[model samples]
Target chain A: MIEFKDVSKRFGHTVALDNFDITFAKGKITGLFGPNGSGKSTSMKMIAGLNRPDKGEVTLGGLQPQESKISIAYLPEIDYFYPWMTIKQAAGFLQAFYADWDEAKYKDLLGFLRLEEGMKIAKISKGQRAKAKLLLTVSRRAPYLLMDEPLSGIDVLTREEIINTLIRDYREGEQTIIFSTHEIAEIESLVDDVVFIEAGQVKLAGSAEDLRINKGMSLLEIMKEEFRNAN
Target chain B: MPTSRLGMFSKLYSKEMRELAPEMITVIGLAVLAYIYLFFKTHDYPFAVIGPVFMIGGMAAFLPVISSFKLLSREWKNNTVYLMMSLPVKGGMIMGAKLTALLSEYVLGTLIAGVSGFLLIYALNPELGQVLTSSIPGIGMKLIELWPQGLALYLTSIVIIAYIASISFFSQMVGKLVSRFSGLVTAVVFIATAYLSGKVGDLFWLNIDKQWFTNGINTFDLNVINQFLIINLLFSLALAAVIFTLAVIIYNRKIEL
Candidate 1:
């Protein structure tokens, strides 16, 4: 679980997150949906302890984000690995820091993703690199996994592979996964909860089915309608 | 089982050093080739014997300084700081790994250079050892004569080198802080700080000499030299520590995009 308490972040004159307050519960797949520059990534970064809020606090479970960092795995929108490192070396490097590293699961995911262990990450295509990053992240078996735009820029089949891989490999009872994506159709059926953000604030958040039943519209349709009304 | 923090730090440093191994080998090879060429061309130049040593040692010390600069800059350019910062490791630990790698490269380079220098000198001028033994008493007298000036110069050089390294490290830190504007700002700040520090140093030295004018001029006191070296060493270490601390604080608190 993660909580942001009146957290605010600013860049020069522009506010990236404005007094934002939200909580994400555990043991569910949560879809964080928003247009570009809607503070979705910022919120995720704060939760992962990669970025500090300018004011207030961001907490994971009962501890500060940094204190809980080892328990959380983060996949950024554009993940960058050490260029000189092979996929295996990268995984091994990560394995040292994390107690929950599952080597068998990592190998299985690598095979499923069709990623070569010896290939340098820099030599891989963007889609393959993204998959490699996902494999590295999910293999950690952390209690909370925060992924920002994991499916973006990948081929349709690769995207489906990624989605299916998450569904198949994710341990449902104890683990929680939160991902932010603009591609709602790919993740709509997979996510149990959804949080919609706009202009640095949470506009709508609830269970996916509840949003459909209460709003009387598909998640995408409601998002479009909300943005249209805001403009 | 989890690696201890220091063990993790060492592992990270080892990885960085391995990444830099190709460059290290190339530089060392080039130095050896140059030493051989110089030996063949001008056998009399003491450098024919010592050249390789100094070249290698200098490169060992200098290359890491240069390589670390490049490594840190490239991380910023590639936006890899985001990934590095997101990891569970402490900010200071990340810096420690980098500094350890750089220092290890420097030490290894120095050793290669030193060994090469010693071997070449022994091979070329085997009689140099006899020369030193015979001249020891006279050289001791000469050293006593020049002890004060020699000590001052040696201490000053050490201080200057430490100052340069600290500035370089600070430049990398500043680059991270300013991001896109890092290069321009780093140059400007480096120049400005260097100029200001030079002026302040001149003023401080003038006061020291002025206060102890007669003693400074008349005292060939070996004790004076010892004192000066001790003070210089302390000053250099303090400055390095402050710069390193600043770097750690910025790294720990500042968010990477």
Candidate 2:
């Protein structure tokens, strides 16, 4: 379980997270739906231990994020692999640090994603890089999988592959996945729960099925309506 | 599925070495080329090679310090720092690997320059070894006779390089802690740290015990010079350790993406 209790973060005078409070339960795929600059990446980075809250605390399984990083596999929206590294080299480097890395699963995903292990990450297309990021993240059987905007700016075909990989690789009762994106429709069927955020605060949140049944609208429609109402 | 600690650290060390290899090779390559040029051009004017060799030696020493500044900052510049920060290891391990890599650059750079310079000079004047032993106003000794002092000087140079690398790492981390103007912050911190440490070193020299040097510098004894080298070496190693620990603390606790 990951908990953010009264977390607030700032850069200069801009508040990235404002008195935010949320908890991601164990063994569920949760979506953080928000527009750009709504602090989705900030929240994800906090859990990845890349960012720290200025006013509050974030904990994973009662341990600080730094202490629990071994259990979390994070796929940032941007390309972060060393430019000099081929996918195979990157995998080998990561393997040293992550005990949960599954070589067979990694190989299978390489084939499934149509990525050659020898291809240099810097030489690949943006879509292929996105797939490569997903490949690295899912190869690990980490307890917490945080994908921050995994499909943002990716071509439709590549997004399909990424979503397909997520659906195929997800272990229902063992893995807790927190996915943040504005493209909620792409992952709507895959997310069990959704949290709608605006201006660094949760505007609404509930089970995906409950939101659809109670509101009589799809997640996309609900997002539009909720943001319109807040405005 | 578990990996040993040594295995992880070695992997990290190898990666750092690979990343810094290009810079090291570029500098060393320039030195080698210069040595080759001097090996031919300075046949008639032997001592003319001294200026260029000394200049290259200075460059070989300074390039690593410049490279050390980029060692941590480049990860951020290339956005690979995200990958580095996400690794599930203590900050000490990351820092240790990088420090060792930078130190390796210094060691390799200096050794190549020193050895090549000595060989080039010896090649130019084959009787230079004998000339050194027969001459010199006071210290009439062969090059081989000064091995003890030579070793002390070599060790002192390494400790000095380690000290400089540690300060560079410390100051770069300080620069990165800020959200803007990181380069400026790094320069300021580096200058400040180096200045303060130099003062500390001066204080140690001024407060030195008389026991080690009861018979002062008028004698010009080799043992006195060795002792000074050893003292400087020990002081440098201690400061490097202290500053490196501070860097590790900043990396683990304070730095943010």
Candidate 3:
């Protein structure tokens, strides 16, 4: 379980997260839903241990990321792999750091994504790089998978493939996945719960099915309504 | 147990060294190539006389700073800090491995220049054993012949690179800690470091007995010169350790972006 207890963060005078409190439970696909400047990426980065909260704490499985980094696999919103690395070298690099790295899973994902091992990350297309990021994250058997904006800047079919890969390869009751995306419909069917945030505050959060039933609309519609009301 | 843990960080060091290979190879290759060009151009001139200066002092000017900037700025510039920071390793280890790889590059560059310079000396004069304690006035030959001097010089270089890289990391830390006027803060820090650099840099050329160590070069006290160089190298290394520790603390607490 990942928990943010009264956590707050700031960049200069601007507060990125304000006295925020939330927890992504074990074994659930959660979406951090928010538009740009709404603190979605900030919250995700905090969870992945990229940013430290100025106030309060963030913990996964009752430990800080610095203490339990081996158990978390994070795919950031931006391209994060070295440009000079080939797909194979990139995988090998991860294999060295992570004890739970699954070589077979990596190979399978490479095949599924139609990516070759010899492909240089720098030379690859943006869409291909996205797939490479996904493969690298999923190939780890980490208990917590934090993916920030994993679907941004990809085409329709590639997004579909990623969604399919998530659902198909998801290890229920074993791996917990939290992904942030503003495009609600892209991950609507996949995410079990949703956390709606805007301007550094959580406007709405609950099980996806519960939100839909209570609001009498799709997650996308509820998202629009919630942020609009907050504004 | 500690060895295995270090092995993991060593793997990172190796990967970083590989990434640095291209630039390192280029500098060494170019230095050697330039030496060859100069040698050919001045066939009638003493190849051994000016070759060492062009290779060591000339080709290597400002290389430590350049190499440190390239190694340390990589993650933030490429957006790979996310990957780097997320790895199951402490910030110190990450920084250490990176510094080590960079040190390897710097050492290798110096070695290549030194070796080629030595070759030119040998080609001109086969009796290389006395080059270190040459009756002739040759600072370059003294460096290659005296192991203590060579090692002291190399250690000083390692410390220099360490200091530069640590300052760069601190700059990132300062930027994240205070986003407003970050540019101004960085500039102030850079200027401050530059101001103090000369006094600190004198550690590399520790000539307590100026004329005895340099000047005609043959009238130097071996014991005194070696001891002074050793003291300077130790001082530089300790300062580097402090800077690195501060960098690690800042990285853990305040480094963002």
Runs of candidate 2 exceeding 4 Å displacement: B132-141, B210-214
User: Which residue pairs overlap in candidate 1's backbone?
Assistant: none
| Estimated TM-score for each candidate | 0.87, 0.96, 0.88
How does model 2 score on DockQ? 0.83
TM-score of chain A of 3: 0.98
Error of 2 at A16 (Å): 1.2
What TM-score would candidate 3 get against the native? 0.88
Interface RMSD for all numbered candidates: 1.8, 0.8, 3.5
Where is model 1 more than 4 Å wrong at Cα?
B44-57, B137-164, B191-231
Residues B110-199, candidate 1, lDDT per residue (tens digit)?
667666766677677777666545534523444345556665665565455556555666666776576468778777766765676567
Using TM-score as the measure, the top candidate is 2
Ranking by DockQ: 2, 1, 3
Ranking by lDDT: 2, 3, 1
Give per-residue CA lDDT, model 1, range A57-116, as digits (tens): 988778998888889888988757888789998988888788889999999999998999
CA shift of A31, model 1, Å: 0.6
* CAPRI verdict (incorrect, acceptable, medium, high) for model 2: high
